[model samples]
Target: MSKTYTNSSTKFSFALRLIVVYLLQLFIKAFDYSFGGVFPLTFRGMIFTFTFVTYWLTIWYASEYIQKKISHLNTISIVTINVLIGIYCGLSSTVIYMLGDTYLFQNGDLWEEIPFYNPELSVALCIIYLLIFTVYAYVQKIFQLKEKEVNVEQLEKEMFKSQYIALKAQIEPHFLFNSLSVLSSIVHTDQNLASEFIIKLSKTLRYIIEQNKRVLVSLEEELKVVEDYFFLLKTRFGEAIQLQNDIDPNVIETIMIPPASIQVLVENAVKHNKLSQKKPLCITIALKENLIIVTNNYDKKEAEEISTGMGLSNINKRYQLIAGKNIIIEKNQDTFKVSLPALSTIDHENFNH
Candidate 1:
């Protein structure tokens, strides 16, 4: 905090604490006088102020310290400890306060004691405060438990996703068959182009393999794989599949993204959409402010189970888990769009290790 804010906050807290203790003292001393009598406006009123303030601060701080120490104890044990702390703090402070009133201010006169020797009721104030603190501690622990659950769930998801993507890339039979089949035909006509296709396909597989261990990757790094992946697809589909990207070079260097995120979206479009000479599938990737936008023509293939939306749901979960951000999806009759938050350097710093 800034110095000015700290000073102001301290003053405010002191004033508020004084007000609370003053009201508490008034409530405690109310029964001493009859209905028509005025409230204490003399020096003894200062003694009343000191009484509640002393008990309040002592029991509050003591309960806080000891409750934290015994947090692992069961409910019944915790309650027993709290009751002991309250009686100790409340009775000890009240007795000392009474003794001080008799000796220091009243010259050891028993009749001039500040309070009328009712320590038991005064102790109830400490018990009430202990109850409040116990409830607070339980609520705080619940939140901590929830946070741990989220961290564990995210770890499990990352593990499953890495294995799923890596295994699918390595074992998907159709992808290899089509690549090699395309290569066989092209190698007969142009050896150089066929070799380039083979190299790009190899890089595509290598990138997926290497990136399985990562939760996040640089935009430039992921974009290189996207380009290679696109080349492999273009080799097989020819002019039927097209990609349009207009990302800033500087943005790509400074930003981070989930590895293979763009590639997955492109592949998803090609998988469930019709791509032919009649109406080609066009996918566009662009940057709009802090969002990386990917949109494709909404042309579903004649297969119901293919549009299950599991792929998009997984992307949403990964974004939320890693960056604490969400990807926005928009779809209509002709186009489907997903706007992903472009993670910056500071954003990546927040990721779980």
Candidate 2:
């Protein structure tokens, strides 16, 4: 048999609340007796107190049942049902009290002194039920807020980890080797152009370093990095690799995205596809329907590239954390395209700093 672990915290809370309600009932009874100018610890008083505690516990159980069943109910229906439950609890408490007085105490005058049905007692019980429900609701709200805070913290940590991993991948030994080889080839042929290429490569590296400290960057800033990266690519491959850019000026300043997103997409295109004079690789960047679309021809090399495929996966995870959106990837026989979310400046500021 499987052993079931009971929720100790829930049981402790219920016990504490029961003690509080019992003390509150005693206080109210004492207040009433003060007016009568008599207070005594009689057997009748002990029995009455016990009955009251039992009555409140019944209402507590009923409230739990209502909460479990009526979650999907509309506001009006839930309120109506809860009100009826309170009325029933009030009526039941009065019956339990009268029965204790008549049978347990053996008091013949109970019928004459305290009537079988007391409207005032029922109303008072209903009010108590409402107060109890209100307190329960407030406590539940506090728990929900705490849970949400924990979830947000976990997500922020995951986002930062993804970004760090992507940076490591971009700055690995193989990438540095290729870039240095390109720079070495141009040094003898065109010294001025080689100088410009070195500057562009430096600028691209500087941007990556700066952006690693931030969760998001403006589209305009990201575009500058992309331009520098493309300049290096164009210098290295010359006419073999071409970038076709058509970006809207208005969207650049207003929209934001995770740092180095466009560069990763462009680098992915270059890495997977073959580039030569006969079959030039042409990559396109454009804006469409509130998204930044980056596409390239699907001319995959015969051998598969050695990669963990974390480029797009990391970008997608970061987008979800920053904008609560998804990156759309589409592939056909000849084209591969990815559409990224274009977040507003306000949305960018709303993320965890």
Candidate 3:
């Protein structure tokens, strides 16, 4: 909620800044003509000034809206569309103002020196205003693009921060305590096996630490971490936990995902499900139809693990931020599955820079 509010405030601030600049330009334009002494300071003069201000404001807003809506188009398309819109808005506002001036104030003491009553001058001024509107809109568009890029960079930073916290939580005391307990028993039984466990444990910890500097990792890189993680889990649980890897080698090399996403899903499965010698917890990792899928058989624990859902939630949020995709999660009586979009090399490259 607070983040949303901040984003809204930033947008409002940008718009208000543009409006202030626009009003100053309008004041300067009005002053240019008023200094000639043709324009007066009476009630009729005030109404004329207000009408002109309204006409300019209408063109400004219409150009702004059209520019934003078609920002994806080439520069030529944007300029052409904005030009047409500005002319239309300018003409419409000028005609409306002319109608009000001609019908509503026909009986008033009008000065011939004032161009407000001249349709020719009104049209000419509207054309000039349209040209100014174009330039102002173009400048605002450039500034808005810069601001959007900055916002995207900020969002990426926040995503990395969330991922760091999530990864750090995975290696904290509670998780280490379990691994250490398993290591302690193995060290006593088989020194050689314990040595292998120590190596795998260190590798897993190393991966988590390395991710502190990374927002995204290649699928193959992520799989290496998941493999090390599975090794530890298998060593600890023996035949009580089963994991299957069914990913295509080609897809693994061409796609990317948020670091530690698979690890989080595997840990989620381990944490939530029952595991026993007779009823092993089964988890599968696969790639299909441009998606990275992780699924597990349902064996929900009698006492659910204490959770804030930070891992999966962060992974979901990060995917939304980086890839503009959502992670799919489905569960039924027999299975729980998560599917994430596998971004292609081209898309991944674009996303990074």
Which candidate should be chosen as best, given lDDT against the real structure?
2
Per-residue accuracy of model 3 over 187-299 as CA lDDT, tens digit each: 98999989988898888888776774555778999998888889899988999999998987776876888778898889889989999999999999998888899999988
lDDT of 1 by residue, 1-353 (tens): 22344466456545654666566556656754521233666666665566668767665556667777987999899888877776665566567656765676674554353464446555665665566556656655765576656665665576477557655844489877888899999998999999999889888887777665666778888888889989988988989999988888877988888777888888878887899867999999999988999999999888744455666777777777676789999989899899988988765665524
What's each prediction's TM-score? 0.60, 0.62, 0.69
Model 2 RMSD in angstroms: 9.6
Candidate 2 residue lDDT tens string, 1-353? 00111244366568867986697567546644422322347767766677777768766876878788998999888778888888887788778766866687776464566566677777787777777777877776775575446545645665677567656856889878988998898889999988998899889887766665677788898988899999988877889999988997776998888889999899889889999978999999999888999999999888975878688888887777566689999999899999998888786676636
**What pairs collide in candidate 3?**
none
Report the alpha-carbon TM-score of model 1 versus the true structure.
0.60
Could you tell me which residue pairs clash in candidate 2? none
lDDT of each: 0.73, 0.78, 0.73
Where model 1 places Cα greater than 4 Å from the true spot, the runs are: 1-153
In candidate 2, stretches whose alpha carbon ends up further than 4 angstroms from where it belongs are: 1-148
